[model samples]
Target: MSPRRHRGMLLLVLCWVLLAACTAQPTTEIAGSRPVDTSARAMLGDLRTLDPCTLADTAALQRFGAVSNAGIVSLDYCLLHLKPDDRTLIQLAVGELTGPDSDRPGDPVVPQGALNIVQNAPVPGHCTRRVRFGDGVSLQVSADLLAGEPGAGLCGIADAGAEAVAGAVQQGRAGHRDFPPNSLALVDPCAVLDTAAVNQVPGLEEARPRPSVGGHQCSWGEQSADAPRVQLQHTAGEPPRILHGAAVEEPVDGRRTVLSVVGGDPQVPLCSAETGHIPFGTVAGQVEVAQLVVAVPGETGTDACAYARGLARLAWPNLPPANP
Candidate 1:
């Protein structure tokens, strides 16, 4: 075999071996940054800056049937509209820091380029294929279907979408979003909040920062029903309002903010402090906001609202300010 062809075969075999290992022993690792395929990384550049919508190729998706790009529904994913049934849809999530937790052992695996794509166990009306490129990071392609009215296997559809993404990377078709200088979409939620900030909240001094799949949201402390936790999210939305309980208007980093508390269990109360409108990109109507929240489950003499507000004050200034 030619040297190039031999190398391709070796890489394909390696992908399958990794997939077998993953199915034999499921991973329990937390989601975070990890090294991935060198070639993919070189082609895609920084994942945090890449535009997820670039992977949702309309021409590629139309192979299944008539499909329309619905644009991006979130910072990390894009939605596509499929025809012939209202119950069928497709979602492509990129730069996701972790594969879906729902993935199970023995889930079907397929090799796509240098990645091992795992087809998650199907739910009642959904199927997902996760293309894990890094230790915990992956791209997810999902299909929503209604049973008994099916045209194609949901998993097969998901795989097709995954193939498109892999091909895009191979062909260097993936692109980056041109975020404004101050866009919240560029912020890493995990970096703004530190251990010392979390330590301010009683009983959460040792809490570790766990970033969401997209790295736009962060949570501290164990994810349990009774554990005290702190969460911070940077998103584009309308200004905050009084949704529950009484709200107090406050200023954090010279920005108008709303602080509110919601009743949960007597021992654990949920409190949140959300900022007023800050400028994001024009695609989201230029409105951006940050939320700092706390939920305490035990008698720690902690005022959830006060902790959330105080954290907000410390973290708000770190966010990129709008240009004059």
Candidate 2:
């Protein structure tokens, strides 16, 4: 999401300055073509209800003072919290390990009943553990224990969390198996926006995968890890659920700005400019409704919002028209 071409130009500022102020659409249920097979194929659907906040059972990681520090969940990614914040603590990311990348083997280890487990240190001081359950379920944990509450045994704790996630998914999304239905669950995020349009962003001609777990994160920026010129996802609750009745903020350009304070969470930076608002009827109004999200890391200045808004506007003409 971003401002129109005429938002008086973008002002470049530091990343932290984006804490200024904002608001944050809706409805759709695209049914899948695959039949429900509970034996081994149902795990992904069951994951929709997995709350990242409670994914790691307290009893499992007893030795540590691990407590929820505000976790965010979506259709594909979850970022669990670790207490005693000091920039160093527990970090967990659980997401689908599909595509050709999952087949590539790495350092070996074995978790109970897991199809494959690979533990690797991508960078110094950081350890990442990945587990693949035979049912196409892959979970990962990355730990860089700096100066935090439970500094030691970060890897072990992450593994425990991974194990817990597997068990939880097997137990079936906490009995919320039949959720309200996420319209964008099976959508291919790349298809949401046109490549030609995405190239319009100054430094985004090259796109990279978001280095985090949760949601399908792809950024159009330099290969510099989290630095994204434009980022996109179709995950659950990342942009927060849009509620009716409240008037959504629409600026003079007809573009919706995704402010930093969205849902009162300064961490989420996004903006959206949509065409022809259509009330969600049975929710599945269009492909972009709840299924597609465009964002900026809020690194520069207000262009993060403008970029998001502009991208949304550029991609709109290509999107399916609103359901009448």
Each prediction's total of clashing residue pairs, residues at least 3 apart in sequence or on different chains, is 0, 16
Q: Which residue runs of candidate 1 sit more than 4 Å off their true CA positions?
A: 1-40, 62-73, 80-95, 99-105, 134-136, 143-157, 211-215, 237-250, 259-268, 276-278, 298-304
lDDT of 2 by residue, 53-166 (tens): 444465665555565533333344344545434455554454433321433455666754423456654554455666554443345555545455443666776677667655
Q: Candidate 1 lDDT (Cα, whole model)? A: 0.60
Instruction: Give TM-scores for every candidate, taking all chains together and pairing residue i with residue i.
Output: 0.68, 0.54
Model 1, position 206: C-alpha lDDT score:
79
The residue-level lDDT of candidate 1 at 232 comes to 76
Write down the worst ten-residue block by lDDT for model 2. Answer: 12-21
- Screening candidate 1 with a backbone cut-off below 3 angstroms (N, C-alpha, C), the clashing residue pairs are none
lDDT of every model, 2 decimals:
0.60, 0.42
Q: In candidate 1, residue 12 scores what lDDT?
A: 19
* 127: Cα error in model 1, Å: 3.4
